[model samples]
Target: MTNATAERPLHSVSVAGIVVREDGRVLVIQRADNGAWEPPGGILERNERPEEGVRREVAEETGVTVEVERLTGVYKNLTLGVIALVFRCRPVGGEERLSDESTDVRWLTPEEVEQSMKEVFSVRVADALDAAAPHVRSHDGERLIAAA
Candidate 1:
């Protein structure tokens, strides 16, 4: 492989947990660096399984332990060049807490969430809810993202 290819972050498989509660509220977090409210997620650490990564990311970001139920959807973002997997999950323990990576965390209703998102989060949210054909989805969704 070329030096550039060797240096490239190896295509990694990461998982995100959509931990929504009974009240139709979805968990969201404001990242410390970007200040954007988004689902709690992170890249899978070396030798870690995707499901474990999902649980760990949720706990690390929100201080809430989550039980991953099932894989909801798999998506790729061409512009970002990352393969993302979303899962339906439920928090089993822990309380609301923020980590160094995040500045805030909260659960909001669908309508309430739309107004709060700084960018296109609805598509990701839809992938999380649309489980009928849950599988790998390509970055084609980017075509729908409004240009900045």
Candidate 2:
């Protein structure tokens, strides 16, 4: 491998699902670790596909089964070097329940999402809800930063 490519630090890849219901509510989880309200997701497995990771993460954290619709946004945590692939999904089955990763699970309206989640996370939901194009954004783990 080339020295430049081999020596660069590796970035962690995470997958998130914005599970929207027929009534336009979005599924969200209150994280047990930090008590932050965000969509259900986690680090992608080494060998897992992005869509599979989304379904697995959503199910694991929120106990909701989802069918991935499309990639809604690609976000990078500039400080953490985490690349998060956020997908827009539709709930197909399963019940809402809490897991070790989440203390609470609830479906919220779009307005509630904007009020509840941090800018970095809320923007992901907003982009998914917007029917334009998938967004590419960078954030400092919480707030969005200007594109470079």
Candidate 3:
């Protein structure tokens, strides 16, 4: 086997992202655990793919079905010990549903997301908005915020 494949160490595959609408609204979910607003997402389980993680998280948190369009960016937060993948997706279908993980879900405009400086966010959101280009991996979630 190639060294790359042989040396493929275990990784935490997680997925999450900014859900957007044709009206320029971005989906943000208020985390029930911390009351912080963020794009809906969660970690991928064993044998699970990042795409599945994003789809499952979005559905669980927002009751919205989403189709991941493209990989916007990848991030690793040293402070939180988390590695996350962020994608650009559109709402496919579902009622606005809330869960223990998310207290609320809303489609906010860019201005609204900026005003939401109440919490640190992923910059991948901004990058996704600015360009569909995929970003390299990061070691900090704070870097994800700058993507905005």
lDDT per residue for candidate 3 within 1-148, as digits (tens), equals 9999998755566788678989989998889898887888888887787888889889988999988888887777766767778889988899888898988888888878877634236465676787757875555544433433
Model 3 segments more than 4 A misplaced:
1-11, 117-122, 137-148
* Model 1 segments more than 4 A misplaced: 1-10, 118-120, 140-148
Q: Tens digits of per-residue lDDT for model 1 on 1-148?
A: 8999889775656777888887768898998998887788988788888899999999999998999988877767666776888888888899999899999999977776777773345556666666576755565433443333
| Ranking of all predicted structures according to TM-score, beginning with the best and ending with the worst | 2, 1, 3
Model 1 accuracy (lDDT, Cα): 0.78
Highest lDDT scorer: 2
- Comparing 1 and 2 by TM-score, which wins? 2
Q: Per-residue alpha-carbon lDDT of model 2 for 1-148, expressed as tens digits?
A: 9999999998999999999999999999999999999999999999999999999999999889999999999999989999999999999999999999999999999999999999999999999999988999999997899976
Q: Lowest-scoring 10 consecutive residues by lDDT in candidate 1?
A: 139-148
Q: What lDDT does each candidate get?
A: 0.78, 0.96, 0.77
Go through the candidates in order and give the clash count of each.
0, 0, 6
Error of 1 at 1 (Å): 4.2
Pairs of colliding residues, candidate 2: none
TM-score of each: 0.82, 0.95, 0.81
Ordered from best to worst lDDT, the candidate numbers read 2, 1, 3
User: By TM-score, how accurate is candidate 2?
Assistant: 0.95
